[model samples]
Target chain A: MNEPTRPLPRANELDTQEFWAATKNKELRYQQCDGCNTVVFYPRRHCTGCTSGNLTWKLSKGFGTVYTFSVVRQSYHPFFRGKVPYAVAWIELEEGPRILSNVIDVDDPLVDVQISMKVELVWEEHEEINIPLFKPVD
Target chain B: MKQRDAAIVGIHEYQSRDVEGKVSALQIKAESAARALEDAGLSWSDVDAIYDAGDGGGMNGLTIAEYFGLKPTVIDTTNVGGSSYEFHAAHAKRDIASGKANAALLTYGSTAHSNARAIGVGGAGGAGRHPADNMDVFSGMTLVANYAMVAHRHMHDYGTTSEQLAEISIATRCHAMRNPDAVRAMEDLEFLDIRETTIDDVTNSRMIADPLHLLECCMISDGGGAVVIASPEVAKNCRKTPVWVLGSGEATKYPQAGGDITASAGAYSGAQAFGEAGITPAEIDIAMIYDSFSITVMVLLEDLGFCKKGEGGAWVEGGRLRFDRPSDGPALNTDGGGLSSNHPGMRGIFLLIEAARQLRGESCSQVPDAKLAVAHGNGGMLGSRHAAGTIIMGRD
Candidate 1:
């Protein structure tokens, strides 16, 4: 039997296609409402704050802090079952948007990973997209 | 219309968790519906409005109405995760008060455990990808991890400890010991230790995710429940004492780029519920909080105004949540709650059923003179996007 792979985003979503396309070049993109100066992540069409269609895409510096995290001791997904006790967190980016990612390059996730710990972005190159991950800044 | 113009006249919880595929989800729902209507001293024809969460299939209102053979007017198929029933109650209340429907029926059923499904370990699955799923699913975010993140943040922000979170599990287990219908009491499930749980029992349990032990999580049981709401005019002639729907509110919370993970939608929904009830949380005698996880109840306790913000860790420390505990706070989970009793996928309907039971002075672990109750249901994930529904009921 073929090994199950990680869940992938559907190709060519109208709102998020640009985001995935940018990831091909290892660029992390977020949106900022041009009208209200509001930051948006996850690449939405309109501003959540003001519902403004006028938005601008900005590249992230990929420096962030751990807003919150959990050391998942159990997962049933085929791709994740073997990787027990990995850390998943919401990273508070310096550019003012939080993104969900795995905190990689940690010895022990429960002991090393913590809230407010500074981290820098790294990329996990997949066939379709370069998934953004974070590692603790030394 | 007055807030108490609509009342819950009847409620029924399907007690079996070991259906073993002998019964279908729709079958359980139809049975619960018939039993609830019988409890209300009303016939099947008395139900003019039907409300369901569509857990069985898409277009739930039409599907459920057709299955029950009802062709009435109002149909609400609000599926906001688990809190859909509370939202349904709010809509049913409005419909009944406005003369749009005299008697409204809300029903739910799930066979999660019997199907041997992984409740929280598996990430949400769908046929096609959505924009939000693309962003988060790659991280391998399981449902338990989502709530575990919230518990981690709460501990970080307020110095909350694992022992403090364990207190919630211990208290609910105490109530579970008193409930004969709790999952622990199932004779065939002899593998389960039916003894009362201690804080150590909770803390020492295997960790599913960081900051959450296995004992702190709710049981996955195959069960369902039904609720009947009617206008005051119809309530007077019901079989049982009417549990007046004094107030209700529903709201949604999501990650707004970088929202507070510790705060839940309960802050908004609970306030609207209590404000419309014209009473404070202190006036509540029983609190049937959705205990999907121990942290769920702890966070909602603070967000629902039962305690000050960031003070929930200290607040739940004692045995204060027990029905028999002598405290100023409301008795919690008098029917054993989702934590120890029964949680079949969407547990919102059980909250309403248990709250109505307490108000009728019929709970297994009854609180004396329980005149007022609050049933708060949190749907989706607390750490991610979620919905909250709050309902306050009073006995006449």
Candidate 2:
């Protein structure tokens, strides 16, 4: 009965706390502008669109579209070597923020990622944290 | 704009293929600064300003200033990319424009390819703090991958082939065949010279990073080059002919700004540079755009106004860069560029060097009667953070 592994968010302090806290109830959250009702990812204190500092944390539907991706076959760091050849993409969330994410649940050759493919979130647990990756919505 | 007088009167460089020391990279930069001042027929007494024309964030300016034992009127350690040197060239113009300072000297050095086991910068782009007591900064993306992705896009969108890229590399090498200043400077290769190789041949060429072959990227070295700029009045008094800075422009596009540079803001920068020079990109004779990657040269051809965007692949494929053709337009990166020239970290000065030399007819492989030459340097890769500087020189 090994404890299920959870993933970490961005390799930074601010985002890591956000990711782990959301999984306290197994939910995915993004920063939403309290004033303009705009949503942003990798939660920040202000709205990039309107320069509003009033932002609130809210759960997201976990949907996005693949804008571009790279199949990284070479690993520059030990932390990423285990996931050699993983699909890393810059996804444009449906709610309007962009994030660097991993595309999961696809078992094709390296060249299958087409631009603007609909994707949904898929969480994978690594040790103490759950990381949210994306999968084709289809 | 009312222009204050500025000119470059002195020039010096440390031409060591390999020079290593115990102190480290910063120390090398300081030492090179000292050497350049001495060779320029000037001492620390002549410099009124100094700055790192690099992408920034490292201790490059502090290092050079401290080493030379002079407090500059203007201090900057800036980095735009390979365009940094050209930026320096144009920076001299703006500095003169604002009456910021009297004379400025730009210097650069890198031991990335030094034989004495010197290390590269913490990384390429300006990001992440260095480890405790380390002078290097970390770069998130490598310049090669940046260029390759752009090259791939250029190919995907405009039918640019690896073979066409191969041709640019081959032709650049052809130019280097006669240059005495380059390591690969004297290779006798033709467009078809390297076309017969397999993917393995391209793959094994030398993976400086990834997605780019060895031949497709610039060389690294532990060397430094310097240029001196002053008011045109002062320049007329220098020992050598002062290469006038007719016009220049610098621009930056945030990495995440747009999907493609076609509709984005790069053209404004080029137009700005051309405007400052009071000439269009069409009037230029020869161009020396930064050449960290072959794709960059291709992109600059379009961006700098040589041709339209997406047409770089075909423009380069033709005999435009060929030497045998009439030297009418676009024999870009004439000194083999970073692809074939000596790319000592800050290779921008080398572009200035080649441009000045061409204007003086002092280049080893001189462009015949090349008077009004244009040399451009991009400060960062694909302009994620781009700094473009254009130098238009005349013999008269």
Candidate 3:
């Protein structure tokens, strides 16, 4: 039996296509509004701060601190059911935007993950997208 | 145009929590609507405005209106997840006060229990694709995890303990034990241990997500409810005591870049509502908070001004939320709430119903001489983006 693959972004996602494309090159991209100098994450056309349309893309060094995290012990999705006891967190990147990613490469997510812990990004290569994950800084 | 006062003249909650294969969502809506209208001493003819969250089907307001065989002039289908009905009640109050409509009806129903839906455990970024799915869903963010993250952050920030969160579950279960409907609902669920839960029971229950035990989570059930907000003219002729809509407010909150995860939209909506009502949290007699999770109620208690921020864990201690508590704080979830009563996908409508019930001195766990009430609903995920609706009501 084939393993159920995780869902990926559709090709028609025009707003985030560039962000995913950059992820393929092992680069994490976010937008900064030129009008208000506001940082926007998860890729958007307009600035969330000032609603400015003139936004510029910026590359992240992929280093951040864990703002918050939860260890999911159960999941109903076929793809995630097998990956139980995984850590999901909101990482506050040094560049000023927060992104939701998994705290990967941890021996035990429940006992290991801590808030405010420094972490650096790692990419999980997928068929269509390079998933950005993070690990605790040594 | 001069604004008139609006009151909730009728309210009805569908009694059962499991109606799978027995009734459709539309049928539940129609039935609840009829019962609520009848409770108001009115009929479908008196309803000129309709509000729904489209929990039934596409074009929800239209579908519900057509199914009920009504020609409502004003139709609203404002859906902000579980808090949709609170938003509906707020809009209906505005419409009635402005003379845009006379009698406004709000209804909701869902068959999640019968469908065997894993609402909290179901991970995000699945079949329902969105623009942000690729970014957030790949992290395996489940609905329960969203709220759990808030609990985790709360513990990290304020040293909130698992025992403090368990108090909310224990207090709600205490209220549920007195409610026959809640008792029946629990008995129907084979997987649940149908009895009043203790702190140990809540803390010891399986952890669905770290820091949030399974007992802290709201049960999945099939139920619906309806509310009728009418002008004072209509309210005077109604059968029940009028529960006046004193004030209402709605707001949305999300993980805006790096915003504080411990805070919720309730802070804005509650402040707006209490300011409009000319009262403070101390004046509230009953608080019908949406207990989607134990953490939900704890954070909302702080945001709603029942207690100071970071003090909710301490404020909820010592059985303060219990109905029989000697302290003067508001009695919480006197009808068992979503934690113990019935939570069919959307629980906002029931929040309104229970508040109205307590104001009328008809609650299963009645708070004596209850004169004021506040129903605050939190929809969507607390960890991610969500909406909050707060309605302040009074006994007339």
Candidate 4:
């Protein structure tokens, strides 16, 4: 039997701490600029749109559409050693930002995750953190 | 006061297969630099500025200068991934034109295949404590994967077929057959015997990432490329004919949440370059755009105004980029590009060198009456953000 694969280490910066912490609670959160109503993922303090310092964290509906995807058959990372032929997707959230995620719980990702396929958050528990993955909705 | 004109007076390259043993990056860079100086009919004493792509690694310009034994007054180590050399050329052009430096040396060297660390993920000997580390969330979002995502989106939005992308690889291989310096590692054939592949051959090759087969991606090889940009007065006295740096532009799009992966900074940089050069896209005789992946060429073609945004798939179809294509538009990548030639991690310098060669009427697959050419370099990931650098070179 193969050893369970480990998720790559993530460096949670000060601005993105809330994002990682929210994942631990099985909630998907992103930051929005209070001044210009700009939505941001992979959080930062200032509004990228208007350079406003005021930003607020909002919970997503945990749903999104597949903007694009790739099936990985080759990877240089050791964590992906046994996990070849997996689907990595860029999900376009309803909140107007895109997230880099994987579409999970599928028998064949090639046929399942066509462009614009609806998906919802599916959190995977690692040692100390929860990684938010996506699975087909309906 | 008017700014002085700057021109590329010299260019050189070093390409190899690392099956022998370990070779230092510094040695490759130094040799290439010395050859470029020799080509320019100058010595190390003539160089007054150094520009290098020092991404992740700090102060690469200083290190290279110390190795080459030159004391440059100005140094630029701007690292924007693969496109750093184009940025270097852009910066060096301005420095020479503004009289900040009389001569600028731009060099790049990478032992990507020979060195295990160069080919491995997170393998650099550093503390690995950088802000960019947070961007690599997906273990599969490597360079090839990032390009695959772009191709996937392009197909989804524009109905681009996999066969359309394969045409790029086949067309490039056709040109690579004539380039002696190009490294052919895919098959057991000699570089000259590498036959033109069919769309089926490309589609059937092993897929590294979905929508991107092995054929569509660039080959890794150890290589070095260098260029010498000098004031027009200095160039006039050089040994070889000078290729004038007509215009240059660069723009960066951050890969954070708001950026569109489908879109690129090419549109902005291309517009700036054209505006500065006072030339339209139609005026160019040749194009030497970066091709880390086939999708990269198509996307840049659309973004640079060579075709309508969604028309890139059709624009390059039916052998439009081929030298013998019998089209009025510019011929592209007459040197086979990074896809079929050599990609030593940073490929921007090769684009500039090829463009200069075409402008000088020195390319093996030269475009007929080629006088003006465009070289665009792209760096970083697909969806999040990246840098685009465009340089226009001309011969009058």
Candidate 4 lDDT for residue B283? 82
Clash tally, candidates in order: 0, 33, 0, 3
lDDT of 3 by residue, A79-112 (tens): 8899999998999999988999899898999889
Model 2 interface CAPRI class: incorrect
Per-residue lDDT of B158-256 in model 3, one digit per residue for the tens? Answer: 999999999999999999999999999888765466788789998999999988998999989998988999999999999999999988889998677
Highest DockQ: which candidate? Answer: 3
Task: Please give the CA lDDT of all the candidate structures.
Answer: 0.88, 0.60, 0.89, 0.78
Off by over 4 Å in 3: B1-4, B125-127
Task: For residues B1-396, write the lDDT of model 4, one tens digit per residue.
Answer: 022378899899775635334666777877889899998998899999998876426666676778789999989999888888888988999888778999999888877766644341221122124434453454446567678888998998889889999888888887887787663443311333366777888899888888899889887777777999999889989998889888888998865444556678998999998888888887887888888888988888888888888788888888888767635587878887887777877789988898888888888888877888899999876455789999888986
Clashes of 1: 0
Q: TM-score of model 2, chain A?
A: 0.76
Error of 2 at A127 (Å): 4.0
Top lDDT prediction, candidate number:
3
Instruction: Judging by lDDT, tell me the better candidate of 1 and 3.
Output: 3
Could you give the interface RMSD of candidate 3 in angstroms? 1.6
- lDDT at A71, model 3: 95
Q: Please, what are the lDDT tens digits per residue for candidate 2 over residues B97-203? A: 67786678787766665443211211222213322101111112234444554665566577766656666676677677666555422232112232223334544
List the DockQ of the predictions in order.
Answer: 0.67, 0.20, 0.72, 0.47
Ranking by DockQ: 3, 1, 4, 2
